[model samples]
Target: MNIKEKYEMSKKEYEKWGLDVDKILEELSRVKISIHCWQGDDVTGFEKTQNALSGGIAATGNYPGKARNGEELRKDLDKALSLIPGKHKVNLHAIYAETDGEVVERDQLKPEHFKKWVDWAKKNGLGLDFNPTIFSHPKAADGLTLSSPNKEIRDFWIRHCMASRSIGEYFGRELGQTCLTNIWIPDGYKDVPSDRMGPRKRLKESLDEIFSQKIDKKYNLDCVESKVFGLGAEAYTVGSSEFYISYAARNNIMSLMDTGHYHPTEVVSDKLSAMLLFNDKVALHVSRPVRWDSDHVILFDDEIKELSKEIVRNNALGRVIIGLDFFDASINRIAAWTIGSRNMIKSLLSAMLTPNDKLKELQDTGNFTERLALMEEFKTYPMGDIWNYYCEKNNVPVAEKWLDNVKDYERTELSKRS
Candidate 1:
C-alpha cells in the first residue's frame, strides 16, 4: 500500500478500537493528580538483591543528581504544584528510603531538605503528607521476618525500626504533618512451614517499642500496609481484610489499604469499603494488575472503571491520594512521568464526575450488571475540561497555554505524517 493508504488503514484500525477521546478528556477533568518522584527518577545505579541481607541500598526510583542541591529540587516541586488545579491539590509521596540509605544520611537527621519541601508547599499553597516504610538491613537482605531465627538479623531490624521512628518524629516536628508510615515487612513463609506466628509476634514487638517512645500525639500512628502476598515468607502481613483492619485499630494504628496489593481473587469494591470504613485517608498505590508483575504503571481507567463509581457513592473523594508506584526502567523517565500523571488524573476524573444518584440507583435497585455497565460512561470522561472547571471555580489561571501546547504538538505530528 502507498504511504497515504497505510496511514488511512492505521487510522481505520484506530477508529475501530472505539476509544473515545472526549470521554478520556472528561475523565481527566474529575480530579487533580500529583506523582511520587521515586517512580519518575533516573536510577543510574539500582541494586535489587544482596543474598543473606534483609535489604540492600534502594537505588531504584531515586532522582538523578541533576539538580545542584535540595533548594533546586524544592523550587521545581513548587512550580509543579502551582500548575495543578487549586480546588483539588495534589501531594507527593516521599522516596521510601530504606535502612542505611542516603535519606538517613550518617545518623544525623539533616531534615533541612524536608523543611525546604514544606516551604515549597507553603509557597505554592499546597499541603504535604508522609508515607514512611521501614527498611530491612542489607545484612539480612534475605529477609527481616520477625520469624528469622537469627538474633543478629533481629537486632538489625530493631535498629532500623528505631531509625524509622526517629525520622517520623523529625517529620512531625518539622513539617507539622503526621509521619504516615506504611509498615510492609518483607517477611513471610518462603520455603517450608517457618514459624509464621513467631514472625508476627516479633514484628509487633518492634512496632510497640517504637510507639512506646514519648513522641508527640501529632505524629499519627503508623499505618501497617499488610499485603496478602509479597517477596517472601516474611513479606505476608495481614491475610484478610477483617484481620488487617482489626489489627491496625487494635494496636491504635491506621491501616493503609493498597488497592493493587490484594490477591486478584477478591472483589475491588469490598476492599474499597474496608478502606473507606477504617483509614482516615485512603493511601493506595496505583498500578496495572498484570498476571505476574503488578506493573506499577498508572492504573488504566479500564481497570478501576466500575469500582470507582462505588467509591464515589461512598463519597471518599477527599480521603484519597493517587500514588504512582512503578519501576519504569523500561521507558523514558519524562514520558513515563507524563503518562503516569495523566492516567492517574484521568482515573480520578472518571470517579469525580460519576453521578451519585446514578450510583445510588444501581445499589438501591439491586442491578449489579447495570451498575457495571453505567461505569462505561466514565471511561472517557473529559479531563482537560475539568481543569478549566476547577480553575473557574477557584479563580486560578486556566491552563489554556498548556492545553494549546499539547494540541499544537499533536497538530505538528499529524502534519508531518500527512
Candidate 2:
C-alpha cells in the first residue's frame, strides 16, 4: 500500500477515538524544538585556546570530522536540519563565539562575536537559544563556578552569565523570536561537604549580582538548570532541584529540567504538571541517560512517551521550551541529531494520537480496568503509518532511510575534514 493510503487507513482508526488526524499532524509540524550546537563539536567550542572538558561533563570517543570551527558547525547543522522533520531552532553555548583568532574572555563577550550565527539563523529562518558555558574553563577547574568560594571566580562567572543574557537578547531581537538563555553551573563536592550552606549562600548572591540589571524578558527568557549530582560532585550539589525551583519561583524566571539530571527513579514527566501550575513557563533539555547523567541520544521509549504525553495532554506545548541536550562522539554526529530529533517528534505525535480525554474520563469515573485496558490496547495502534506520512509530507527521509544520507555526507563531507 502507498504511504498516503496507509495514513488514510490509520486516520480512520484514530478518528474513531475522537482524534483529528489532520489537525494533529499540522500541530506537530508547527512544534519547533531547539537543537544544541555542542553536539556537532562534541562540546568543544571554537575558542582560540580551548580547555579540557570538566565539571562532570565529558564527551567520549575521538570521532573524526568534528566541527573544527563555526563555519563547519553551521554547515553540519544545515545538513542535519534538512534530514529532520518540522521547523526547529539552534541552541548555542557561550564557547561557540567567533573571535577572529583573538583572545575573548567569557566575561567580556558581546553579541557581535556571534554575528555569523545570527546571520546564518536569519537566512535559514531558525530561532537561536543561548547557554552560559560554566564548565570547561580554568576558573571552574574545581567544579565550582557560580557557587565558588573565591570572590574573583564568582564575580568572573557572574559577568559571563550577564554577558550571555545580553547575547540571548540580541539573538531574540535579530531572529524576532524569544531566545532562551539557560544557566547550568557545575558546582558541588565529590565527597561529603563540610559547609553546603556557604556555597548555596554565595550562589544566591552571585545570581543576584548578575541579574541586577534587567533586560526585557520579551526578547530573552532567562532560566536556571539544576543537577542532583555530577561526575565529580556525587555527595552533594550546590544547585539542587530544590534550590533552583525555589529561586525560580521567587525571581520569576523559568526553571530548566534536564531529563538526565535527577535520580534514577525520579522521572521528569511527573514534574511537568506541578511546574506548570506554579510557573508561567518552563524549559526542558530532552536527553537519555544510561544510569547517571550519561547523555546518550534520546530514544522514543516509555519515559519519553510519558513525557510527551504530559506536555500534549496538559496543553502546555506553548508553555514548554523544548531543546535537545546530548553529545555522543562514538557514531556519526549528523545521524545522532537526525535520529534523536525524529524520535522526539515521533513521541509527541504518539502522545497527540492517544485518546487522552477518554482516559481522563475513565479515571474520573473510577473505571480503572477500562483505563488500563484501553491504554495498553492503543500501544499497537498504527502510529508508524502516521509517522511515515508526516516525514514524507515534510520532505525528509522516512524511517531508517535517513541513515543513508548521513553515510553519504560522512564520505563526502566529514571524511574530508582533514
Q: After superposition, how far is residue 182 of candidate 1 from its true place, in Å?
A: 2.2
Error of 2 at 72 (Å): 0.9
Write one digit per residue (lDDT tens) for candidate 2, span 1-418.
9999999999999999889999999999889999999889999998888899998987988778999999999999999999999889999999999999999999999999999999999999999999999999899998888998899999999999999999999999999999999999999999999998999999999988878868878899999999999988999999999999999898988899999999999999999999999988989999999998989999889999999999999998899999999999997899889989889999999999999999999999999999999999999999999999999999999888998899899999999997
Query: What lDDT score goes with residue 94 in model 1?
Result: 28
Compute each candidate's TM-score over C-alphas. Answer: 0.67, 0.99
**Reference-based lDDT, residue 79, model 1:** 36
Please give, for residues 81-129, the per-residue lDDT of candidate 1 as tens digits.
3344432332333232323324343223334435655565555554444
Instruction: Estimate candidate 1's alpha-carbon lDDT, on a 0 to 1 scale.
Output: 0.49
Candidate 1: residue 178 Cα off by (Å): 4.2
